[model samples]
Target chain A: MGLESIPVVTQSASDGLTGNAAAVLREIAARLESLAKEGQSGIIDLGAMPLSPADKAWLADKLGQGEVEINLELDGPSHVRETRYAGVWWLLHHNPQGAVTGEFIEITRIPELVLAHPADIISGSESLNFLIDDLC
Target chain B: MREQEGRLVASLAQQGISRRTFMKYCATLASMMALPPSAGIAMAEAMASSRRPSVIWLPFQECTGCTESITRSHSPTLEGLIFDAISLDYQETLMAAAGHQAEEALEKAIEDNKGKFVLIIDGSVATGLDGAYSCIAGRSNLELLKKVAPHAAAIVAMGSCAAYGGIPKANPNPTAAVSVSDIIKDKPIVNIPGCPPIPVVMTGVLAHFLTFGSLPELDKLGRPKAFYGETIHDRCYRRPFYDQGKFAKTFDDDGARNGWCLFELGCKGPITYNACATVKWNGGTSWPVESGHGCLGCSEPDFWDGGGFYKALSMPANPLKLAAGAAVAGAAAGVAISFANRAKKGAAKAAHETTTLADLEK
Candidate 1:
């Protein structure tokens, strides 16, 4: 008799993107690092490679790479006052199947901007750090 | 011809249950323990042959709701059945003896069982203020657990109260209660946790031990995975609604009335893992989610400490921001849809050209 291994749970579309989106994210990181070194006031758009063979092909055929980076003073959320945080790097990844499906963007890198709250100098600036914890 | 046969006959004579029903119950218990049918027969054989395994049920800083819940349990009269299931030699709460006599029974049980017999601890062991918040026989609950645990064959830390210190272990915990696993580090402690664990689950754990001469497999937190395998959400009837993005916006909303998803109404089923949705309570009648309220995740390690039930879990979103990612996905969908439309139109046009050429030839 033929045998079949029953899959336990069918992962949702959202989890599809979650699966190894990290590898694609690495390519975005490499590009971001090079652009940071330019040390010039100009938009460095990553319009070309989308961290995947499929995404890169799509990029190559249409809009090669992306628009240039723009530095502007924008309104912060209600919690934070007007504070300029530089290189708030955005990482975009392409997933063939996703909840939202396809390409998605996330703010990946950020330095600490101590919010001048009424309370004490909330010691270690850990809350503002963009890096995820070890549990990840 | 044998004394063993006579005793078996006597035990059987005392009960109305037949061997068949007994075997069936044993099998059900085995399945509940995540054991095969063979194990059920083994349990039946063990019950038939072996002498009753003595049990010492200890109560500590608790509301005794665990005991109350067990007593009220109806299914197979599990609490009633546990007598045949185990000796249940001494329980401070339910025993006939009281004051010095009760204390004597506990001491005698510990002495008689020695290195055998299991210990079933029902509540948290409070060490705070020299355990003055609660006391028995001029000694603390911690002292009693320490005294009893060393002699136990295995320890069943029953209820969230005994397993994870329950509500007493919540923030600013005044009593400084500790779980049975914390102090009884030498012996393996099987934690069957709930606000008050399901009665069948408690007996099932015992059944597995009696049948196999060992504890069933436990999770990282020393809970039996059979009953705690998947989240309540995974097994919840409302799970279908969650998949369809249907949620109860308010407590008395249409979705709530229809038994749709409780996610929006602070239901913790998605994060809480337990067999409640499947095994249910009161003889598989209904669980909390089925009745009305969202699951509070009473079986988990730190159900009390977890923030608001309505608060979305703070799990890392696959390193992709779901909201902004969704926006991009919307744009991509538009592009894809348009491309499909254009392709369809082009194909139709080509077909029309071929048809027109055929018509002209005719």
Candidate 2:
């Protein structure tokens, strides 16, 4: 007997804009301008806002995807993707169980979490030296 | 369990939690609390270097639902990590000690961290019959609270029962139960009120105390303004539907199936101040309103006595009897009454008075 395939349900894009999606877009634009002028980065926490699924979908549609997509495995899995706008990045952090813990829109050249820490770099260098000594 | 005597960062590292993960957790908490993004770094640094503050959890006349909610927090979760960072010296439900050993643990915790530990109370204080209604280890809850409250740095009333005398203090109030603040006037008390409060709210309060060495800014009800500043209605997703005047008249009606507002179904979201709509519950899962149920106003004082659960807020306890021809007129009257009530609620929000026991009666 053949197994039945489960149907996937997706939310339809709302006919009318709801909530503060427009306000958030304006804020993102302002932040992007600030980033260019003063090199100051900004982050908007989507999780904290009272945004609906339609609002989020509208946001994603308006801020079209860009080329850069990066994934990091830290405490859990995190995805960072640049928006169509060069400096704006969308980040989603999840737990080990794959539930989203935080969602953010970071307006910067690169997200701070993506950078390798100084302590980690030093430890990595020390470990490489220890490996070299053992071989010698 | 007692926290390891060392910097929190080192202890966290020992448990295999990386510094980056800890920082991210702090950032998430900061975001949730509406603190500036930069505050996350400061919170992370302060908490990482600071000693884990000792917490002593006391249960009075509760059902242990608050304890259950907090413990159900997922393993290695941000809230769970904050809970881990604390030295839970004595918690009757979670602690291994029992009877004499439990009493000894409570005594030792108070002795070792006198005037420094956080006292978390999960239930109401029964004052009737000279507090005979509830007793622990041969001592009345009232007596135990009096003995322990003075020695703590701050008290956190963890649920509606401890905050506003919850169900036990509803009509009749047989036990004459009173809130923690009603009994202990000298100490600073923060009330995290709910039927069973959102677990992250508990840990958020702890994180704030750990980061700033003081309680978070509180509302008139001694609740953290960060979590209770806005009414649930202000942040509810169905608010747009409410604005459009679309309401679910009955539970399984077409409006409800279409996900319209629950205002007519007796939702107390308009007056209830809580973070359930935004911060959510059970690890960012669906909250009560999200699951197609109206809010019970569990976070507010005297919620249990706030008329019937199914009666609309605009309606009187005993609804008016109207003729068949006057049904539309009655609907219009209800709408008018609702508008007037909304204006009154707006004024009340503007004033934000401290709810007293007398107010609970009203």
Candidate 3:
């Protein structure tokens, strides 16, 4: 009697581009090594990069969400959410009219948009001193 | 034998799992244990006719998560039925007997089934401060284990705690907790290690024992190699994405939402080995990875101390400046090794003598 191996099918392969996805994952792994070892952070500008909707969605689902989330509404509306990767942040800068201006993936402890610039820090110091004088 | 001779078969029939289904389960177990297909029939026959083996479960410095994982896995199903069929002589958590009565029952069962019963232990054995760290029935876990180990035919160390001291044996282990193997040196011990090892794994080991009258082949760490042979990454669904150079930079980014891969998100699937990918938790529903969470690598030894759960296995915050130099050096080494191999081959070829028909005849 002829016999063949009974294949145990756990799941059907529905999503293609798995090979491409794996290559990108390896690059990310290397980047993660760099991020952890050298305290260096780089931004991947989605606006600048050409990625299909499917590829983008695939990346988002895999990354998951991180512990930190920062929301800004000073100028118009800006959203910053950290991905499951501790230092990876998703930054969305909105225009004053509430239109999306830029989208970026920032790899850092804190996104640049939310950080207080040197000029802003000096202005904040002056404002605080003025407030203290007014209170006195 | 006891009245439990046909009890398991009868209960299985009542459960409506069918002989075919029961046989299928046995076959699956056999395959999982890397046994021959014919062994499945043997397992079915053995389980159907043999009386249930007596099991005495002892919990020590633990969280009872192992018990929960086993009982909660596919409850009201065949696995549960098989678990129920086992003659559990004494268990402090599930048994109604308590205090001196429970202790007496444990003693009586050990006496009644000496050299035959299976002693299943969850949690670590505490030896610190005169074993005052964890005491039950006014006896330290170490004391109880020492007393009961000799009478047992085999000892099943369930969960990381019993197998490798688990979290209790993490850095600065306060209780001086040690694994079952640390204490019971003479008895044959099978370690099932996980934060709370996969439930089916526990049942699989039991089935192997009940069928073969002995434990399955074990790896160096005393764990059944069938389940822990491959890393989670090797069997992960998103492994394709990892190979494709696609990663999600942010949680809500397009890459993540599309479920590219979580290697960048500090997934421990690579170095950590377990059956989570294939045997999904909560009855083949979904595991931590499927649910969009990085594997905590709960099955590995000293998982708690492996590093931050969110940190990638061997990554740095910044790129190494000497990476290019290292690559050049690695290439030189590779070239040198290849030249050496070629030289050896050439030398062997030069020394070779051609075989002639006359020489062969001689």
Candidate 4:
């Protein structure tokens, strides 16, 4: 193809995340801080960390737009990714106790996204867990 | 120092650099030195009068690639500018003498400017087998380094070979190759690491030191932060491809020609810290990744032992993930296009109806 062959996404990138991601992250961070005060150690809960709303929105928009198939594949240790298309996000996560491990047990957000990110989980040592990635 | 610098300034003026241009060069140097803009005049004064500092260049376990890289630099014909800028009294590679005369010259330079001249060591020091892997004249590299480095003002480890031991210091190093920092402890040493460092960067550091009388602030790795601060990936033009999840899996694939991200093709750019993307090579033209090769992360410490250059760390998720994403976008675009078409026809029909009514009235 030629230079003009590429389709450009003219949308502004400055505002990818809405308040949802921040609110969720703040809730999670606050809960983690409280849990630490109560003596819970050894859980690096990166998942509890707030996802930048801008990033989420960017991911969401790209899914709503773009070529390239992306999917979250979280299996075994170090398996994590954040992405979706046609208005969806497949984020595989652990429960409050951090014992149960599986894929798709909890659907985090979608269809105008309503979420509650608890903060207690992040209080443990090595609690910060999630690494956001655009799936390819 | 000022008076010595003034003589050089007078020489430069005689060679056609105007006082204003000289000051401009000073201002640029000051900026590169991380000094305030006003420091330019001070730099100008320093350059005008500072006595030419003596320097010693030692070649060790190296391929001479460092010299080639530096010499290839266009701004300062690496040889011409380096010697002109400093009082280069002894260099193993460029000096005329060979045998005892050369050795004597080196001894004289070191003694003449003890604790005042800069010592630039160009390769790693091999410590295995009584340091027999590399030798200068009749002495081992280790012995030579210990003897000559004690009275140097500052040390500039000029290549990855000298800075991080390059390939020799990689895994299973039988020679026990070590960096300049490993050997020299007294004087603060600045490492300019690359397979061979950027010519501009090397000169920039030299100019910064000459102008300000001190080394530039360094990163945790002891490399000048100005050049190694941001990662090559961060400044790359293909960053959008990564964000969009468009990647080239194979070297000669369609995606590669289409200008997709090279992460899947073992691109270490994401983890590599260098000015390759921004500063580029060969006069800001293009680097390896730009010329269509994954980053080797040459500037990072211990890069040679990192992993297979062809293998990528899929630790980070590929930007595009789900198969349904493309389908979803295509479907949405189709719907949008159909809706737009419907609206256009609808307006056209309405206009036709209005025209018919006007015809009846006529």
Candidate 5:
């Protein structure tokens, strides 16, 4: 099948939560509570949670929106958005073919994926220095 | 003590690291250290005001792999820069001084920074043949460690060799290789055990000490609980597969390509503890399992002797003659018991009569 021909199914409210979404939301809530109490953060794999699109929307709506919103492009474009509830995060990873490959609800002060990788940052700085030297 | 060079904040600013970036680094370090969220801000404040701590690195009976893991492999990293910023009084590999000059430098640094410097040692201490197996400058590693350990405030045993006698101490051990904990009994020692530990772990431990002026909480093996408290399996991305009983039978199988659990392929993640799953390698790029290889459990003691790397941890037990006979006997007993109970119940029901209002009054 051609990549262009593949149907892109964007999740909407109509795609609502799977039956197990309640259990997952409960788990996420418990995780968030512990994070708030213990001062530690952890990742939650929504990919394995078996939630439907509606459930995802329910979670997204429940958490609301926070100040931080980071977008990453690696295997594909990943949306990492923080919720109004402090320290809660919603991460959606799409494959190169534009299909939702993985989804997670990370509960950490800062998600690992959002952080600037040390090696990449170093390389970037080095390249800029080289560019400046060339320009001079 | 070694004199302060400059405050970390000023140095970071000079390196073109903005306050925002520096705070982010501090926050990341705080999270990695398992400190409270607000502690990130506290750490930023502390580190900004504090001077770089003095460190003395000693290498013995090593392959320099640990050094490479921290310095070369993770070069240009903030942690690497933090390592560089420290007052590295002496390091055999990186230091320009050698021969008598090197020995003199080590002595002077120790004298100057007595009871204040952080003594970081890599490699194992060999006791066989009067510790002659490994020596530096005509002195055995054991003797040198004994001499230097007394004056230092804290000792960090970096790498599996230093923490628990790695490959050298495996099988019919000839060197009588012993960990740093084996010899130094008086001082506090932190074991950062791995074939080569994560670079950030090394820096995190240093940062913890710098921030609090004390060692972080340690596990039973004298390792920081923050990093070694949980098994890799618990934090693995493929844990759901393990729970679902889906495993990759072979490396190239469909299950393997689909990122199934590698339990059947001798994955020691269930037993091993480290930050590879979360922190990852090469600046959070990927780890061994992500690259399609089972964990070697290098961080665990005697990992080299933990059976074959490709062999499963355990296989389902086969039904033997004894087991079969036991099963049969158990089934027979259950049948006999149930039969007797049924007979008794049937007899009681047969003999029983329904009671009317008059019988109830009586």
Candidate 6:
């Protein structure tokens, strides 16, 4: 049979309730609380976890969307979105081929990947000085 | 040792690969290897500063499918980048040098890196006919492996053939092929067993070695526990159907269309341990079971000799006759063995229940 003949079975979000999504939600909650209490940043590797598609949908629904949404174009496209809860962000990284390489949940003020590195800032400062020199 | 060149980070930067992209690649690898998120930064630092590890690939008695799997794995892939980062000193099929020049390159690589480079074996070592079944540059694979395996820091068996004597070592084997482990017992060996293993797995192992300065934690079968710990059945999408006792009897049945479990159709998912279920193939597109076929159990030992691919793993040859015989026997021994049989069956049932409950708890 052709690949197109294969039936696509999409499990409902409710199906996630019977799975490990509740436990994962509880873990996320605990991490979020820790982040608020001690300013501790944490990351949950969603790609490593055996999360079903339904579990992912349930998580997305529960987290809801926040104001901040970012798309990074580097080796590939990466999406960084804030969850409904402050200090909680969802991240998805894809390779240049457009296939997802990793997914994660970060409990922090801002995800680390979105921040500019100090080394880049130093290089930028050098370039700025060079531009001023050329102008003179 | 070869002169210490510029750091990997500087080299990648020269190639237009930024530090941010490198960090992202490290993070992806860290997640894939089930390492802590912070370990991604550590991996990035380690790989950036450290020199590229030398690798010497040795092909033996088999097809070059393993090489194809790694090289042609999704273009501009992180794994591809990781491979590019390595100093592959010698590879037979990929390298341009041939004849004595190729042999000289191999000798030079060994002499330079001796006891430091990673040795990757893709095919099985044929021991039959005084090791004449497979040879390169007038040297038997057996002699070559014996010579090279000693000086390498670690060896990676890259395919089922190199890991467990794959198809060549099947029943009535003519070549008397054997796995790398069977011959090289001293060196640390990691088996990435598959007809052709997933591309990322090879790179993941290499990344782990590069970052940690040692091999990743391996399962009893000498495979990395991160990828090979869970069986295909444990992580399969159709697992819920299997739990509900729904199964497809034939290729085109309604159950098959509904995506029921292929247990009756001889799916070896329950026995095979590999990352195909979750990590998937062809850029995470789909695996064998997802493509509407039973698992061939390529990762397991001696899978070729297990049985016919279409025959159920545990089904009796004649179900109706066996059931009828059991019924008749039960009736004849009703009085004599009933109490004893009930006791034994009750104990067995209790054990079964406990095991099932424990599995559900997990």
Best by DockQ: 6
| Candidate 2 per-residue lDDT over residues B1-362, each given as its tens digit | 11322456655766788777887788778887888776777787777767888999999999999998888866445566777678999888888999999999999999999999999999999999999999999999999999999999999999999999998897568999999999999999999999999887888899899889999999999999999999999888788788888898987777776778898888989989999988787667678887789998999998876654655677544223322121123435444544655665667668995543223212
Q: What is candidate 2's CA lDDT for residue A134? A: 100
Q: Could you report the Cα RMSD, in angstroms, for every candidate shown?
A: 29.1, 10.0, 26.0, 26.2, 17.2, 10.7
Evaluate fnat for each of the predicted models and list the values in order. Answer: 0.00, 0.24, 0.00, 0.00, 0.00, 0.44
Candidate 6 lDDT over B1-362, as tens digits, reads: 11232356656667788777888888987887788988888887777656788999999987999999998886445566676668998999999999899999999999999899999999999999979999999999999999999999999999999999999998657899999999999999999999999988898898889888899999999999988999999989888888888889987888887788888888989889998988788887778988789998998888876655665677543222334221133332333344544555678687774333212111
lDDT of 5 by residue, B65-107 (tens): 9998888643254665566447888999999989999999899
Q: Tens-digit lDDT track for model 3 on A20-107?
A: 4445545566666788999876655453333445666777778778888777663345678988888877766653445444556667
* DockQ metric for all predictions: 0.01, 0.24, 0.01, 0.01, 0.06, 0.32
TM for chain B in all models? 0.82, 0.85, 0.84, 0.79, 0.84, 0.85
Which 10-residue window in model 3 chain B sums to the lowest lDDT? B318-327
Q: What is the C-alpha lDDT of each candidate?
A: 0.61, 0.82, 0.74, 0.63, 0.75, 0.82
- lDDT string for model 4 (B1-362, tens) is 22334456555545654444444444444443345545555665565557788989898898888888887664442223434668878887778998899999998998899999998988899999989999999798989999989889999999898998987887568799999899888888999999878876777677778877899889988899877777878877787788988888877777777667888777888877777775567654568877778988788777776644665655332122323221132434434534654665678687774333212111
Instruction: DockQ winner between 2 and 4, please give it.
Output: 2
TM-score of each: 0.61, 0.81, 0.63, 0.60, 0.68, 0.85
Ranked by TM-score, the better of candidates 1 and 4 is 1
- After superposing candidate 1, which stretches have Cα over 4 Å from the reference? A1-136, B1-13, B76-78, B310-362
Interface RMSD values, listed in order for every candidate: 28.6, 5.8, 29.4, 24.9, 11.7, 4.9
DockQ of 1: 0.01
- What's the interface RMS deviation of candidate 2? 5.8
RMSD of 2: 10.0
Q: Which scores higher on TM-score, 2 or 4?
A: 2
Better of 3 and 6 by TM-score: 6
| Docking level for model 6 | acceptable
